[model samples]
Target chain A: MTGETVMFWVLAPLTVFAAVGMLLVKKAVHSAILLAFVMIALAIFYIAQDAPFLGIVQIVVYTGAVMMLFLFILMLVGVDSSDSLVETIKGLRGVAITTSLAFAAALTSLIARAEFGQEPLGLVSANANGNVEGIANLIFRQYVWAFEVISALLITAALGAMVLAHSPKSSEARLSQRARSVARFRGASIGTAAGLPGSGVFARHNAVDVPALLPDGKPSDLSISSVLAERGDVQETKRYALDGLPKLDEEDK
Target chain B: MTEYASLLLDDPIWLVAVKALLIFVLCVLLTLLAIWGERRIVARMQLRVGPNRVGPFGLVQGLADGVKLALKEDLIPKAADKVIFIIAPIISASTCFLAFAVIPMTGKVLFFGEETVFQLTDLSVGVLYILAAASVGVYGIVLAGWSSGSTYPLLGGLRSSAQVISYEIAMGLSFVAVFMYAGSMSTSEIVDSQAQWWNVVVLFPSFVIYVISMIGETNRAPFDLAEAEGELVGGFHTEYSSLKFALFFLAEYVNIMAVSALATTLFLGGPAAPPGLSFTESWLGGWFTFIWFILKVALFFFLFVWLRGTLPRLRYDQFMKFGWKVLIPVNIAWILIVATLRLMTQEGASQFMLAGFIITVVVLVMLATTIYESSKAKAEAAARFVPEMPEPSFPVPELPKQKRVEL
Candidate 1:
């Protein structure tokens, strides 16, 4: 087989495997990353097919921008928050499975009916006048209206996102309340700061920026979620404890 | 000499491999040289004696550093996702190298008694390919940061990805003018189009925008908030050590070189000689064109170092605001103006009509900008009015005055 064919065989399976992995992964972050792999594989397939412009666009727009956004949100939200198994909508799973299977069957049938060996219709070869030009010619000359409509749809989506994200009045009220609290804090005496300091036996660290260290030299707070802590997700050792060495077993003694 | 050189047209597989290998080596060497050059230049600017121990004037300091990195013990944070953590640097380094494939290093040159181009490979969508590689490079950083299972690294990765995406839009828009004028996305064709005059001379606005966006795109100083030492520690690679850390560092320098090479290819005219230098053609032969390309790239590298030494990092919010609110809008406006001008010229419109159209567009744009600025000022004035709140009273302690002493 030619190198291109070899590449296709390798990438196609990898893409499918990654897509499956994305669904199977319990961690949302892992799923997002797997999706990126799938995207990159698809981009390579586009390049193998000589659709250089499309391939690059796939990487740039989907794998790069979209997947990064997904990963960013996933990281910010933390990884301990797994999706609940409880179904919010009754019978939704059954409905989803049925629709998915029907769609799959229809797509398979369509693909089986298509003539794979024939030259593509209404599309110039990528190398003829260069891929960019060929694509541009089609978009501008033939599919101009569709292109403009898609762009309009995109703009509308952006506007909708802005409207959804905006909450000006509530935000302003929250900001004012925060300002009032800051003002109140500024007026309070040093001793009254942090709302009645811990008892002398449990004195907190004086520095505001650093995490408070307990008297025994352990960090007072863990930044990770409680769920993660319960699952033993904390990797770094809390402290070096010389006294915590295991006592001799009773049987051995 | 050929006006333009096409790439990978029926070349043997062995020849293609050789070209790829050559470009890879060249990029690696350039990155190392750039590192040493940056340190020396920045030191000179700061009036200090830089590294001089490794080789004459510290030329081999980068190599020494590389060896040290290789010998050092590799450390992976226990919390890290092992698979993604390992692949992150590989992705970064590979993508950085990939961008060079489309950069035209020289026009046709004699190689084994056959005419060949001095580029690894070129695609019809050459500029887009470079852009794609750059975009993909962001994944390396983001994944590294996320897989580290650390807060700062995650933040850094997110910032870097956002910064790249925002600036890329402006960068792509800036290229619209160049593409319109050159009539091709192929690097060699763009270079050939600039034989008479460089794009920087005629398309000054696009040139300026591209330079600014390129700086942002590469995460260089004034736009390097992603890895800001004061805020994010080592940023996305905070947990990486040894060869992995070295790979991240290598990727950064390689990215700088790739971006500089791209800037050279796009605006400065890839491997073409400067307009007034006829002596190069007669005395130095056509191969001397590569020198011109390297010199242009080096100039950009110098600019990067200069900015790093001079400027303070911008605040993250302000950086984002400037990118999304200012650069992108300005780039779009500029593209529209350029498109109209190209259309007018292509239509062979009369000089009067062309001038009239230009004036009308400029006036309308100015009017719109002025109105927007006025409204923005008004909004700022309104938002500055914070509601006054009564001050709370608190008891204070007094200290006794100390005894006075003679000065």
Candidate 2:
């Protein structure tokens, strides 16, 4: 066999194995990193075609930026929970394997059967520049709008992520207020709600008026701090109020 | 057939591998030499002896240090991600070494009864390869930080990763100008493109942008926010010890050397002597260009040391802002200018007319922008500071002749 065929055999398995490894990885982050390996393998495949520009772009854009973004999103959402297996299905697994195998079989047969072969164009020929400039020249002239729309979509995704990540100003303030009110209501005179302590739905001489926007809107005085206390960890964040510094230490008593 | 296999058949695999190995070794030695040179030069500047305890005016100081570092007790923190921690330094060192494969240290020399370049190898996509190598080094730092299971190291790694991404965009934009001028990315062909005149002259703006990017790329001051000593304490290598620590150190120096070598190759006309000095004559053999190349690299090496000594470290935000805001935008503008000039030249425009027109246009644009921005900024500054009119100060503090005590 020619060296080209030998090289192809070596590289083809690498790409397929890496891609399969990427898909089969249990941890999402590991999967993403494996996908980078697959992208690098594919980049090498492009190198075999002498499409160096596409090869570099494949590695740079896919492995570098997009995968990094995916990893970041996974980290932000906190992967590695037992909830991941909640979507697992035995029937889907069988179908996935069968379909993927069939697809691979069809693709390989098509490749093997094709009589198409190419030789590198001469140095001064039209194909010499790897179509980077030529494609750009044509693309900007024709599909510029689509390219811009893709860019806009990316911007929108970025903005959406930013919006989702940010806590609304009013809700955080409301939570902080709830915690502070709990601290304020540890008095003996108040009609404390159902709890072990004298803390909760307090009444000062028959005056127990709690704010709306808490659970179920009515002034059932369901006691916001009691709810937060049940939740546990958010107490520190509740203490992240406007100068809870002195009062928080007092509440510990 | 001529194109497909002639190049491969010209040189045997063993010979090429040997050259590759030699290039790797040479780059390491170059890095060692650079570290020593910087210490000695900085010491001289500060009027002190540097590394005199080592062999012969501290000539082997770097070697001694390397050996000492290897002998130190290796400490892997209990909390670090063990696999990534182990892999990080290797990744760092390997990527830094890979960039030199395409850098022609000398022109074609006769080897093994065939003509083969002194370079390890040259690919059509050599420039992008260097970019990839440099970019991969960022991951090593990132991995180092993340693996360490320490806060400061992680911060250092993240900062470095961001810094790499920020600077790389500007660096890529700068390459567009070079590509437009040379019409190729192959390093050897790039050098050949500069056979008439160096790209450093025609693409000076690109070279400048690349210089800025290189400084940021190598994490030189004032761009070394990744390892800011005051804030990060040892930065990404904080948790590393012994051979691992040494690898990170070696990687840092190797990257510095790689960038200097790249600058030498790209702008200083890779192994070629300056204008008027031709090694084409038989008296000056092909091997001699390597000397000139080394000297150019040494000059850049000195510049790196000089920057470290001279510039204060920039704030992290300011560093990123400089890369993304100033450098990338300026680079894009420069690429446009370079492309326009290329178009003009290819269309048979006279060099003098083009230069004159470009200069006038640039000067006018710069002047107009400066006036607009400065005027706008002046008002903003006035509004912010709101400087009140100053009254003459009385030394007695307007206390109405209270107590003549100069005591």
Listed models, DockQ each: 0.19, 0.06
Candidate 2 has which clashing residue pairs, if any? none
Candidate 1 chain B weakest ten by summed lDDT = B394-403
| Model 2 segments more than 4 A misplaced | A5-15, A24-27, A72-253, B1-9, B279-284, B349-360, B372-380, B383-407
Candidate 2 structure quality by residue, lDDT tens digits, B273-388: 78888845123446777788889888988888887777888888878888887888778776777677778878999879898978987898889799989999876554444223
True contacts kept of each: 0.37, 0.06
lDDT against the true structure, each candidate: 0.80, 0.72
TM-score of 1: 0.82
Chain A superposition TM-score, candidate 2: 0.48
Poorest lDDT segment (10 consecutive residues) of candidate 2 chain B: B392-401
Which of the numbered candidates is closest to the native, going by highest TM-score? 1
**Which lDDT tens digits does candidate 2 get at residues A160-251?**
99999998776422324444344434433233323422222342222222221222222322334455546552223222122222333344
